[model samples]
Target: MTGIGAKALQTRWFVRSPIPLFRAGLGFVFGGRLLLLQHLGRTSGQPRYVALETVERPATDRIIIASGFGAKAQWYRNLQADPHCRVWIGFDRNRAAIARTLTREESAAVLSRYRREHPKAYAQLASVIEEATELSIDDIPYVELHLS
Candidate 1:
């Protein structure tokens, strides 16, 4: 899906559905590949949640997520404002995790490895993000979450 269809799907209209289920604590159903991020709203200062696919779990306690919407994504901005956030991976929940935005070189290498490992997912995600953000996937920001 591309153009208006992809844009529509990328917007709240399509993305909002999973949020409720994720919030209801059913994110584990998606397996370890996805995570439910509970974060603070940038402006409202209210709690918000978004289900994001995990690009990689380089270590037992570390996971990486890509922000396809780049720096404009609310969740990304929120993490920047306050690195504190919570994440749910499978049946495991981390109450407080430190979020760190990855540098361009780091993200490039990470994405390169991701594409090699998950070719189909890499292409699909890149398309959705490109259509939504009107930019290349290389511009997408990646964040590392350190769980304690």
Candidate 2:
């Protein structure tokens, strides 16, 4: 599959650009669709931030996000080392939270619902993820962030 290389994904200016907005407490501009995840780096133990699309908001305090780059993603790896983190969602900034990797069954269910509700987005995301990781959407890693 034709996919973006690691460098292309990491160096994309636009991907990291919104981070400033979230840091500036203007994250609400993205509505509830995207969130800024502030997690501790696995090696450095320093704060790292990444903006990710919300695959599902199952509850007021729970959100689902996927790792399109598979387990190799730095953010996903950091969350694995330390699940504790913070979230900046619409109108909410720097809220304490915890991250959890979903089981295969849980990921399947969430992706199913996401596909149903957001067919267009799911189609595009699935394509990019599949191309990048050479894995089916169901095989991608999904993380649930629970706010405190």
Candidate 3:
């Protein structure tokens, strides 16, 4: 199957009813393997969630890149307005985090690492990253979830 097709399927299954079990299963299979991001809507104050492949710095902080599927995802924009967010890793939730938009150089570095580690997934993201790379930091927010 195509990459997008696979991701869509995964997303559909993930957001379906019985949210707890599905999320736990996802964490069991991909936790620490994936960075689960939770963002609040800029105006509506509703929560939004997405699972992203995570990269860690030498300092052991969790990092996630935007590279939104469509450059128009509301979560990305919400994060621009408010950098605070919650991150879930392996069924455990860390509610205190401050999102810091990465510089082009930083984003490129993170993307490079992600590509090296997850070639297949990264291939699917090529187009998004290409467009996202040029966007201002506010447009493509990259956040490092600091677990307290």
Candidate 4:
């Protein structure tokens, strides 16, 4: 694992509480530039919470990739099996969302936008994506939350 990856994992387990507050603060300050709160599958059908970077496409009515640490994470795999989920943006509680796997063309366009908008994250991920060889502008699953 890269240093950043190891650090992030360490922080996730070690620095738990303050991180949520910090993420919420970032959401407020940046306005949609914060972490995504996703639910994961557990043994008893309960959910696990994970914070990830989220991209929203207002024009397309979609929330883009989580791409957690470059899409190799367990959360990504969980969503693949079950598409229904809850998303918490900012101070919101568990809001319902539907996960959708984008078409190759759709994924390419969305990923392109992501690279353009979040260059730093893009840079951090570019090498991982390339190394995975499974990475493509296409086939990156994106989730679309249903707005009430």
lDDT tens digits by residue: candidate 2, 9-60: 5566867988999999999999988899999999999999999889999999
Candidate 3 clash total? 0
CA lDDT scores, all candidates in order: 0.84, 0.88, 0.60, 0.57
- Every model's TM-score: 0.88, 0.91, 0.66, 0.64
Among these predicted structures, which one has the highest TM-score?
Answer: 2
Best by lDDT: 2
The worst-scoring run of ten residues by lDDT in candidate 2 lies at: 1-10
Ranking by lDDT: 2, 1, 3, 4
Least well predicted 10-residue stretch by lDDT in candidate 4: 129-138
lDDT of 4 by residue, 2-106 (tens): 455445544657524434664454444434554455556733456766665566556323466545344556666677677678765655545677777666676
At residue 61, candidate 3 shows an lDDT of 54
Per-residue alpha-carbon lDDT of candidate 1 for residues 1-106, written as tens digits (9 for 90 to 100): 5576467656785777666676677877888888888889978899888888799999978999988777888999999998899988887875579999999999
True lDDT of residue 9, candidate 3: 33
Candidate 1 residue pairs in clash (backbone atoms < 3 Å): none
lDDT head-to-head 3 vs 4, winner = 3
What TM-score should be assigned to candidate 4? 0.64
Clashes of each: 0, 0, 0, 0
Shift in Å, residue 105, candidate 4: 1.6
- Ranked by TM-score from best down, the candidates are 2, 1, 3, 4
Q: Model 3 over residues 1-148: C-alpha lDDT tens digits? A: 3445445534656534334543565554554666667789999888877666565543445556564533466667787788788876666655467777677677777767777887877675554344434443234545556555
